[model samples]
Target: MASPLIGITTMNALRHDGLAAVSLLRRYVIALTEAGATPVLIPSAMPDDGVDALLTRLDGVLFSGGGDIAPEYFGGAPHPRIGGVDPERDALELALLRRVVEDGVPFLGICRGCQLVNVGFGGTLYTHIADQHPGALKHDYYPDSPRDLLVHEVRLKEGSRLAEIVGVEVFRVNSLHHQGIERLGDGLEAVAYAPDGLVEAVEVPGHPFGMAVQWHPEWLTAHATARALFRAFVEAARGSD
Candidate 1:
C-alpha cells in the first residue's frame, strides 16, 4: 500500500535576509514520517484555486501550531494581547478545513490549528486565556521551558473518540497557547479538559476522523499517547486510500 500523503500547514515568515518563506517545525514532518505518512508542507499563501487542487491529492490534513488567528474571523474585537495575526493563512486554512470537513478527509489540528478549526465552525475563543479565564494556569510556556515539558493534565471524557485512541482517561500535555476555545463549534464535541475546565481536545461528530488537541503532540512523539494519536490519524488517512 502507498504511504498516506498528509498535508501539514506551514507558517508565514520573513527571513532576516529579507526574503519570504513558508515555515513549519521539523518535528511535525518527523512525526508524520514516523507515523508512516508522507508529509507535505502546505504554504499559508496558496491561492483559492490551488487550495482545492491541493486538497484533492491529499490523503489527510494536519494543521500545525502557529501564531494567533485574527479576531475578526471569530466575530471578536481585537484584544491588546492578541499576537501576530495572519489573514492569508487564516483564509487558506479555513477554506481547506471546510473542504476537509465536507469531504470527510482524515484531519488532525494542533495548537493554533485547533483554534482555527473551532472558529472555522462558528465557535468563539478567549483571545488570552489567562486574561479571560480567571485562575487558569499559564498556558503560553513556549518561551521559558522545553517544548516537551509536561505542563498540565487533561482528563479525557468517557466514551470519547479521543479516549478510545489514547486509551487513557487522563494524560499530561504541554500547553503553549494563549488562546483557547470559549464556545465549541457546531457538530463538535469537547472530548478533554484541563483541571481548570478549559477544553483541551475536540472532535467532530459523525466524521470518519476529525480531531484537534490544544497541545503540541509533535514535540512529545516519544510518549505512547502522543504516538498513538498520530498512528490513529495515519491509519485513518490510509483508510481513505
Candidate 2:
C-alpha cells in the first residue's frame, strides 16, 4: 500500500526542470520515504493557481532548503550576495505554508524552510549572518567549498520538541546557510540554538508536530536521531490524515 503523500516545496529551476523540480528535495525525499510517507515535490511557481489542488493531495508539507528568501517580504533591502532569492517561488511556498499552518498539519522546515516559515508568519531574517551577528561563531564556515557538509554544534532547548527528536539535549549538525532567523513569530517556540545563540529549531504551540530546524539534518549521516525527527514528523502527519 502507498503511504500518505506529503507536499514538499521546491525551488524554481526552468521549463526543462519539470514541476517537482521546485519542491522535491533529494535528502528530504529519502528522509520522508525512510519514514514511511510518499513525498510529493510541488513546484515553486505552480500554474492555474493550483495550490489548493496541491494541498488537497498532500498529507504534510516540508519546506526544503535552497536560495535566500526575497528580503522585500519582510521590509528589508536585499543584500548584494543574496543569491537565488526567487520572488515567485517565495510567494507560492509562503501561501502553501500559511494554509498548512492554519489547518494544523505536520510541517518540517530545514534551513531556508525555517526562514520561510518565520517570514511567512511576520518574522524577519538576517540577509547575511556575518553582517548581522558580528563576533558570532562564523556560521558560514564553508564559503565556496563544493562539498555537501559543514559541521557545527547546536544547543537544544530543554523540554522542547527538538531535544526529543534528536534524542539529546545538544548535538552537532551540518550548516550551509548564510541567512539565519532574526525575529521569531508569535506562538512559535524556539527549541534549538547554534553556539552563537541563533535560534536553530522552532515548534508550534499545542500542535502535534510543527517544527523547523535551522540546520540541515538531512545532510547528517550516522545519525538515526535525525531520521527519527522525520519519523515523528511523518507519524504526526499520518495521524493528521
Candidate 3:
C-alpha cells in the first residue's frame, strides 16, 4: 500500500466549513490526491498538549496558504494592512512546525505557509510592502480579471534544489503574496527569489525534506514542474532513513 499524505488545516474558528473556513485548501487536497497520496487533514486548532497526537499518524505535513499570521508571533505590532490575522491558527501551526522539524518529518508549506514557516523559525516578514520593499509590482489577488494568469520571472540560485526541480534558471510564476521573507530562518536557506529580491522559496539543510514556496503551485496542478514538486514531496515523505 502507498503511504498516506498529510495537509495542515487552519483551525476551525467559525462554524462554517466552506471556502472561507480556516483550513486546508481544496486545490491542495486535489493535488496531493492526484500525486498518489491519500489526503489527511490536520487541524491547526489542535491543543498544545495534543500536538504529538496529530504528528504521529502522518508521513508528511503541508501548511496551506491563508491570511496573515499575527505579527505578535514575531514580536512586532500590527500594521494597518495586516488584516485577517489568526492567532489560534498561528499558535497551532507554529507548534506543529517546531514539532515536525524535531521529528524530522517531511513537510511543504505554501504562500501563507511559507510566511508561517519563516516566522515560526524566528524569521520576520515584510508585513506592509510600502513600509519595507518600496516600489514593486503589486502582488495581490485578482479574482475578477480576465487575464488572471499573472506572471513574474524569478531567478533561481545556481545550485539550489529549485534549479534541479524545475530544470531552469529563470521561470515564470504567479504572485499573490503581499508579505514576503525578510530574513531567512536559522536552519533555512532560500532556494529561489524574485526579481525584486523577495525570497520565493526556502529549504532546511540536512533534513528529511521540508520546503516552502511563496507561490501557489497547487493551483497550477496540471503544469509539468508543479507536478514534480508534489511528486518530490511525496517521495521524500517515504525516506529510507
Candidate 4:
C-alpha cells in the first residue's frame, strides 16, 4: 500500500533573498512525515485549474497556521491587530476548504486554519479575542515564548472524534492565536474548548475526517496526544488511497 499524499497550504511570503515565494513551517512537514504520510506544499497563488488537478491527486489536505484572514470574508469587525491579510491566500483557502469538504476529502486545520474552516462555512469570528471575547485568556503566546510551551488546558467532549483521536478528555495545549470562532460554521461541531470557554477544536459531523484545532499540535508532537492526532489523520488519508 502507498503512503498518503497530504497537501498542506502555504502562505505567500518573501524568501530570505527578498524574492517572492510560497512558504510553510518545517514543523508541519516533520509531523506529517512521522505520521507515515508524504507531504506536499500547495502554493497560495496556484491557479484554479492547477488546484483542481492537484486536489484529485491528494489523499488529504492540511491547513497549517499562518497570519490572519481578512475580515471581509467572515463579516468580522476591523481591528488594528489584524495583520498579514493575504487576499490571494484567503481566496485560495476559502475555495479549497469548501471544495475539499464537498468532495469528502480528509482534512485537518490548525490555528488560522481553524478560523478559516469556520469562516468558509458561514461562521463568524471574534476578530480579536482579547478585545471581543469577554474575559478571554491570553491565547497569543508566540514569538516571545517558546513554540512548544504548554500554555493552558483544553477539555474535550467524551464522544467527539477529536477526543477519540487524542485518546484523552483533557490535556494542555499551546496557545498562539488572538482569534476564535464566535459562531461555528454550519454542520461543524465543537469538540474541545479552553478554560475561558473559547472553542479550541471542532469537527465536521459526518465527513470522513474533517477536523480543526485552535492550537498548534505540530509543535507539540513530542506529546502522545499530538502524535496520535496526526497519526489518525494520516491513517484516514491512507484509507483514501
Global lDDT scores for all candidate models: 0.92, 0.79, 0.77, 0.93
Stretches off by above 4 angstroms in model 4 are none
What TM-score, to 2 decimals, does candidate 1 have? 0.98
* Tens-digit lDDT string for candidate 2 (38-132): 98777766776587887777788888888998888987557886998788888888888888888777889988999888888788888988888
Clashes of 1: 0
What tens-digit string does per-residue lDDT give for candidate 1 at 131-240?
88868988999789999999999999999999999999999999999899998998889999999999999999999899999999999998999999999999999999
Q: Arrange candidates by lDDT, highest first: which order?
A: 4, 1, 2, 3
Candidate 4 per-residue C-alpha lDDT over 107-181 given as tens digits, one digit per residue, 9 for 90 to 100: 999999999999988999999999999889999998889999999999999999988888889999999998899
Task: Please give each candidate's TM-score.
Answer: 0.98, 0.90, 0.90, 0.98
RMSD (CA, Å), each prediction: 0.9, 2.6, 2.6, 0.8
Error of 4 at 137 (Å): 0.5
The Cα RMSD in angstroms, rounded to one decimal, for candidate 1 relative to the true structure is: 0.9
lDDT of 4: 0.93
By TM-score, is 2 or 4 better? Answer: 4
The ten-residue window of minimal lDDT in model 4 covers 45-54
In lDDT terms, how accurate is model 2? 0.79
Judged by lDDT, which candidate is best? 4
